[model samples]
Target chain A: MGHGGGGALSAELVENVFLPAFGGRTLAALGDSAALSLGGARLAFSTDSFVVRPLFFPGGCIGDLAVNGTVNDLAMSGARAAYLSCAFILEEGVETSVVGRIAGALGDAARAAGVEVVTGDTKVVESGRGDGVYVNTAGIGLIPPGVDIRPQRARPGDVVLLSGEIGLHGVAVMSMRQGLEFGVEIESDCAALGGLVDAMLAVTPDLHVLRDPTRGGLAAALNEIAAAAGAGVVVDERAVPVPPQVASACAVLGLDPMYVANEGKLVAFVPREHADGVLAAMRAHPLGAAAAVIGACVPDHPGMVVARTAFGGTRVVDLPLGEQLPRIC
Target chain B: MGHGGGGALSAELVENVFLPAFGGRTLAALGDSAALSLGGARLAFSTDSFVVRPLFFPGGCIGDLAVNGTVNDLAMSGARAAYLSCAFILEEGVETSVVGRIAGALGDAARAAGVEVVTGDTKVVESGRGDGVYVNTAGIGLIPPGVDIRPQRARPGDVVLLSGEIGLHGVAVMSMRQGLEFGVEIESDCAALGGLVDAMLAVTPDLHVLRDPTRGGLAAALNEIAAAAGAGVVVDERAVPVPPQVASACAVLGLDPMYVANEGKLVAFVPREHADGVLAAMRAHPLGAAAAVIGACVPDHPGMVVARTAFGGTRVVDLPLGEQLPRIC
Candidate 1:
């Protein structure tokens, strides 16, 4: 049943859960959708579904992950995060405590991103029909003035930038799913990027394109951007950022470091000349401390993304034939 | 996977299948969510997930059934249909032709309601982790001015109306799931209700509440309304308006007609003074030709709903304890 039931359960979810955490007038209305005063800016809308296994993982659970994923997607489009709609598919027989923890995390996450979870739905499926819980979050954010960004805007001469270390989110989930332990607990790279992205936008308003590699990872992301923009991408293997622990984990699992997913990292394609300024901006943010100028756009091999190896071999990184990490979002 | 992949497979589900059949401008965005102008009115949003088994059943398959389900939900909120965002979860090894047929049905159903399926996603899960296919559709609509309908608005003396014959949707799925065919085919009454709702609004723009009895059926919906408004609901058993085939199916299944679902029908609460006018308008619509006045709101037994029996007995109807049809929506 939908939580709009306004009964004892709905009250528990709202009063003991949502209101104490993400309190907003529009959200408090509990309407079908929040009505916000957007000040006339065009809206950028995005939606994502979260179904990570072992619902609870290091760094965050599905609740915060769901909120952060959609918020980051909006940030990539240079939009100011605003309102969100959450839909949950819960398996029957799930512990009620897990539900509370997830709901509380959602409330906190929404407040952290300065957004409202104005509307939501909850459906219960038989234990076998579903995993533990799946969440679908959809949101609308206002794109501020003078921020023109899209994947198709990348030019041949643009420089590719990495915000931070990659493969953290991938390794973290894999470790938890397989019951593997790291001496120094490998935490998820799960984080919200509204603030960090805002800093980059402030310093370099003309940033061209931004994307977060979550499912198919950096390789798939670059391939998509290259194909969409009709340009080739060349990455310097030495310049790309990767955490030592994450790299080790990927090696142990026979996964490519470049193909491992990242939840807290973003790739930006900037005009060649503005790359220095953008890199400086990225480095100034705490979340982007490991940012680097890792690649550049090339016109000669349009629609292909080639990564140069440390041994001087260059291989084209194409879109994966199939999803390597399903339910990562 | 979480089924929001915007890639070749997703495009295949749309282009090779969805476009030629259910085409519209909004369907052209192909973004993460449907962005609509909404015609300058307050926006209305609704979402539903369909996990009905035996994907293709007597009345409809997953596509048109899902499209109609979500569209009807929006119309229940007294909104003018605009656009929809469709996300599909397909089990691996499922045939592309079957998926294409479902996509075609999606397009046709949207067209029937004068709505658009603007943006969509698709992903494949491992066979055991999912059923054949699950469709999640989120809709956005625009609420007309002076229409402030809500479940909490029902007051004493408000009239409860049923748009048409009930239990068709539930019976269709149940029979298909159990593989128990009746003497003749009793197809599910799956359809979009925008036209019927619009006609009702024309007669009484101030309708208090509207809802489609889907998963837990009419009994659950009425109980929800009563509890939400803190009013007692009284329905005459003889006035419930169930089709003979549906009643027969329910009797054989040992399920109460009131607890069975209806996809092509709606339950409306209108001010008593305007109830007749609204019913007349609903009767004019093809989808609501069997519309009837079922009950009325009462103040004496607050937060409760009771139905008078044809045998001069009465019983209280409350929300379901657990899902009646798990994963059906």
Candidate 2:
């Protein structure tokens, strides 16, 4: 295991190792979720393991993060999540109260997302062999008819819309982990995006691509889509919204907001004609009130993402070599 | 996390913590797998985490065990596994070659089991926080029409049939971990049982209950079924089949074969009228050549399992308070 950071090392691991070992057409697509068909019904399947440190955070904990992470992945495929399987690995001697709180949080999150935890497993390890608790969730969702969303669908003239502010989750987790007091406390933006996704799908089911920028942040997500579609993404740096506190924290910590994780946000690549309607729908949703048109897919500089700065200078926003914040969820 | 054993503590954790936290009719059943209806298709879903020590065992490695474990869980619900999602938490500094071997074995196992690895994830943790590698697999299978199976379906006069020999899997892993020589090398019975289940299902679709004797072994499985169905299981001690080598090793180690884990074996509760037909079908399958009728459901002493001793005495076989062998898959 080279590095857990969702960066070049992670990409290499998947390309060099996992892809060769687990060969199949769906996995080769490398989307946030895999679209599948079972018994004539279209489905989306995805899995994620949460190892976030400092179990409890300002706005959410690992419990809710575990539930939302996989749910958001399924939503990215334009699927409404229906069922999930949860597995927990706990360390010996860990407080049962801590586990109870986590389980309570998980239950609440599942209820809020309107999905059921249909099956689960629990395992315990010796005290020193594991962190307090690690959770893995795998989910299956129903892909509505006439909807197809994937990274490779990003083509020239597609509008790139971001759901809200960036970098709050990474900044929030890091501040709590290091005991740094930013004048204003920043809470993690961890929430289920299924409702927001459904709202956008109502506007149009012909979305080209939808991605939740979690690990490696917006930069990584755009880079992946660019590479997959063999198209360039040109962004208006000034158009991207960053809250005041998160901006100050990232500046003080020398972390770029572009590469910081956001748990409750999504970036969509939509056809230009439907972009206005989709943006309107997203703005109406509570979760996407601050949605903005941050960029657009371009034909120039294929397989790259370029940002036009306020000073009229252009720079490439590349995928980070490693994560700036590890275990941020 | 009192003990990582699938005994009293595990049961309490599920009953007191998980059950209340994740409440739904499907999960309330507490079956080996959850039977669900999605878009007019009946599906079986299950998940398992493999933390067995000594990644490479006598007969199989953690990779194949991960696939087969979840596959077997789904098969217990009489479903043919179609897809799986694998998530790996790797410890830093683990050799890439070792991961390669594990992934290779996983691919081979999935092919052998006739399931596809559709989606997966990988995360690396700092060394010492995790064992070399831990795998979690969640699978979904299509349940055929007219088949209804669950633990609560057992009733009086139902015959209990075991798929094959017991205790080899736990013994094989233990010998490797502690470097113990039992005179004869015992390989783990770690094969997928989907084909064997299919052969059994060919005879009839009205089987009552099916369980894979894994972590807590035959005793635990029987106790669970008896409790669920509010019936007693009466077993003829002489009729339960244990291999001679396994019996010898268990005797030397002061372990009872009755409480030892078996990976590729299953115990089925069949209506007495159909017992002979099902037994013949099981015996005809390669994985169930040693199938035997070890017990029968009875009305006396409900919610317990009793084994008739060779001396014609009956004794209750209580579930162990903790596991005799920890991390035996």
TM-score, each model? 0.84, 0.99
DockQ of each: 0.07, 0.72
For candidate 1, lDDT tens digit of each residue in A1-329?
Answer: 11221222333434443343323343343321222332243555566667777788888888889888878877887886766666666666666567667777876887788876655556655557677677777766777777777777789899999998898888888888888776778888888888888988887788888888877788877876886688989999989888788877877778887877788889999988788888898899988999998989998799888989889999878666555555555
Q: Second chain TM-score per prediction?
A: 0.86, 0.98
Off by over 4 Å in 1: A1-41, B1-41
Q: What does the lDDT read for residue A218 in candidate 1?
A: 89
| Candidate 1 local lDDT, B238-307, one digit each (tens) | 9988778877887888888787777888898999899989989988889888899999999879988899
Best by DockQ: 2
Candidate 2 Cα misplacement greater than 4 A, ranges:
B1-3
Best by lDDT: 2
DockQ of 1: 0.07
- Candidate 1 local Cα displacement, residue A201, angstroms: 2.9
Query: Candidate 1, overall lDDT?
Result: 0.72
Model 1: lDDT of residue A133: 73
Evaluating just chain A, the predictions reach TM-scores of 0.87, 0.99
